[model samples]
Target: MSGRPPGAKSVDQLLEEARSRITRVTPEDAVSRMADGAVLVDIRPQSQREADGEVPGALVVERNHLEWRFDPESDARLPQATGYDVDVVVLCQEGYTSSLAADALRSLGLTRAGDVVGGHRAWVAAGLPTTGGPAT
Candidate 1:
C-alpha cells in the first residue's frame, strides 16, 4: 500500500490542481506582462541564483517568504504589495515550483498571480536578459 491516506492526493495531482487555478505564461509573454507593469517574482534560492544567474530586474523573493512578502495584508509585506489586484508572476529554476507558488499567491487573493511556462531556463533559452553567473 502507498503510505498516504485513502483520499490524499499525489504531488502530481496537487500540482495539476494548483496549475488549473492560474494562467501560466511563456517567457516572452512574461516579458510583455512585465513591460505592462506586472511584477516578475523570482522564487529561486540564493544558491540557485548564484549558479544560474537571475532575471535582470525580477524581484528576488525566495519561496519560503513569498506568502508574507506578497500578502498585502501582512505587516511583513513589501511596499509593492499594494493589494490583491496586483499582477504577480512567479518564477523558479523550472516551471513546476512556480506554478505551485503562483497558486499560493492566488489563495492569498492575488487574482493576477501566474507563472512562466518553462521558468528561468525557458527565459534564458528565449534570450531574455539575465545577470551574474556563467552565461548559458
Candidate 2:
C-alpha cells in the first residue's frame, strides 16, 4: 500500500463503487431497449470500434467528448441527447469505462443513463447485431 490515506481507494475499488451506483444491463437487454428507442451510446475509441466491430446503429460518442456530447445544455450535444429523462445506455470495449460514463451522465441530470454489463465484447458474444465499418 502507498499509505496515502486510511481510506484510499484503488482503481478497481472505484470502478466497483461506480457500478454499484447504477443499473447495468446484459447485452440482450440492451439490444431490446435499443429496438425500443433507447439510445445506445458507444464510448469506445474509433480504433477499438474498427478492431472488433460495433453495435449497428449505436451512437458513437467517444469517451473523451462524452460530457459535451451528452449534456443537453452544451452546444456540442448530439441531437438525440434531448433531455434529462432520455434512456441512454453507454458502452465501452469491456464494460468498465461505460459505468463511469453512465455515472457521469447521471451527474449531468440524465437520470436514466446506465451501462451494458459486459460491454461490446459481451454484445458480440451474445450474437447481437454488429457492423465492421468506419466509426460514424
Which candidate leads in lDDT? Answer: 1
Clashing pairs in 1: none
lDDT by residue for model 1 (36-122), tens: 999999999999999999998799999999999999999999987999999999999999999999999999999899999989999
- Per-candidate TM equals 0.96, 0.91
Which residue ranges in model 2 land beyond 4 Å of their true spot?
A: 5-7, 133-136
lDDT tens digits by residue: candidate 2, 17-131: 8887778999988988888889999999989998989788899989999989989999999999898888999999899999999999988999889999889989887878789
Clashes of each: 0, 0
Model 2 clash count equals 0
**lDDT of model 1 at residue 82?**
90
| Residue pairs of candidate 2 with colliding backbone atoms | none
What RMSD, rounded to one decimal, does every model reach? Answer: 1.1, 3.0
After TM-score superposition, the amount by which residue 13's alpha carbon in candidate 1 deviates from its true location, in angstroms, is: 0.3
Question: What is the lDDT, from 0 to 100, of the residue 43 in candidate 1?
Answer: 98
Angstrom error at residue 4, model 1? 2.6
